[model samples]
Target: DAGITQSPRHKVTETGTPVTLRCHQTENHRYMYWYRQDPGHGLRLIHYSYGVKDTDKGEVSDGYSVSRSKTEDFLLTLESATSSQTSVYFCAISRDRGTGELFFGEGSRLTVL
Candidate 1:
């Protein structure tokens, strides 16, 4: 395996609740990303980090936020879960600098009721 992974391959949550998913990587790479995949739409970036405690919002960062306090750990938090938020979440990383090509995790399925 390269060095990236996501946890809780499957999750079910109630509407308006808060949920947090974990992404762990051993690569120690400088870049980490979170993307959500939904039918008909391409993967949308939720957030990303350049280094420990260095992060920023991405295109679809509204209801989601992220934190990276360690080089090997990045956490994504869904402030208020909704049915619309149900989708497959993927954690990605790049061993190289910003070339845009990313390594993806298997994916985490989240279902909100």
Candidate 2:
């Protein structure tokens, strides 16, 4: 985690509650991404940011929202968490999307009961 930081590494919350996970990076990479890992689904992209204030939704964007106010910080918010949302979230940084090299944070484990 040289350039990345994730807060609330572990969380337990009830269904329908709101949850937010924060990812901070010092590498100043141009692209930051949010991904969730589940047993059957493997790793799925939730959202991504290309630059400050420039973000986009990913394949699994439903039920998830993301914001990036600065180059080093990205936020992921689950408006209303659900049991299906229980998964380990990872933050990855990359200079370019096609580079095939992504620096990932340890992870943020969130369990929605």
Candidate 3:
């Protein structure tokens, strides 16, 4: 289970509406990332946090924002979601630099209409 949990596993929202997906981890991992998976794009990074209150933007972060205020919680927000943002969002946790392997959450499916 990786001790990771994503909230609102499925969501449907109208265009221009606000949406927020939560990722909660019990393993106390030091690194966390948010990614969106699509048919052709595969998985694109949205944002990532290395520690509490330390976040960085990634390739597909144009319409998204993220916050990490605690070691166990990371929040990804879409201030104004659009249909183009509809995808399966995944949260991944890594305890090491690149060898410990990543632990992924079930996923949050967001549909914007």
Between prediction 1 and prediction 2, the one with superior lDDT is 2
Off by over 4 Å in 2: none
Clashes, model 1: 0
> Would you estimate the TM-scores of all the predictions?
0.95, 0.96, 0.96
The worst-scoring run of ten residues by lDDT in candidate 2 lies at: 1-10
RMSD of each: 1.0, 0.9, 1.0
- In model 3, which runs have C-alpha deviations exceeding 4 angstroms? none
**Cα deviation in Å at residue 22, candidate 3?**
0.2
Report the Cα lDDT for residue 81, model 2. Answer: 98
lDDT of 3 by residue, 1-113 (tens): 68999999999999999999999999989999999999988889899999999999989999999999999999999999999999999999999757948899999999999
The 0-to-1 C-alpha lDDT of every candidate, in the order given, reads 0.90, 0.94, 0.94
Residue 52 displacement in candidate 1 (angstroms) = 0.6
- Clashing pairs for predicted structure model 2, backbone only: none
> Per-residue lDDT for 13-93 in model 1, tens only?
999999999999887788989999999999999999989899999899988989999988889999999888999999999
* Alpha carbon deviation, residue 32, candidate 1 (Å): 0.2
Among all windows of ten consecutive residues in candidate 3, which has the lowest summed lDDT?
95-104
Scored by lDDT, model 3 comes in at: 0.94
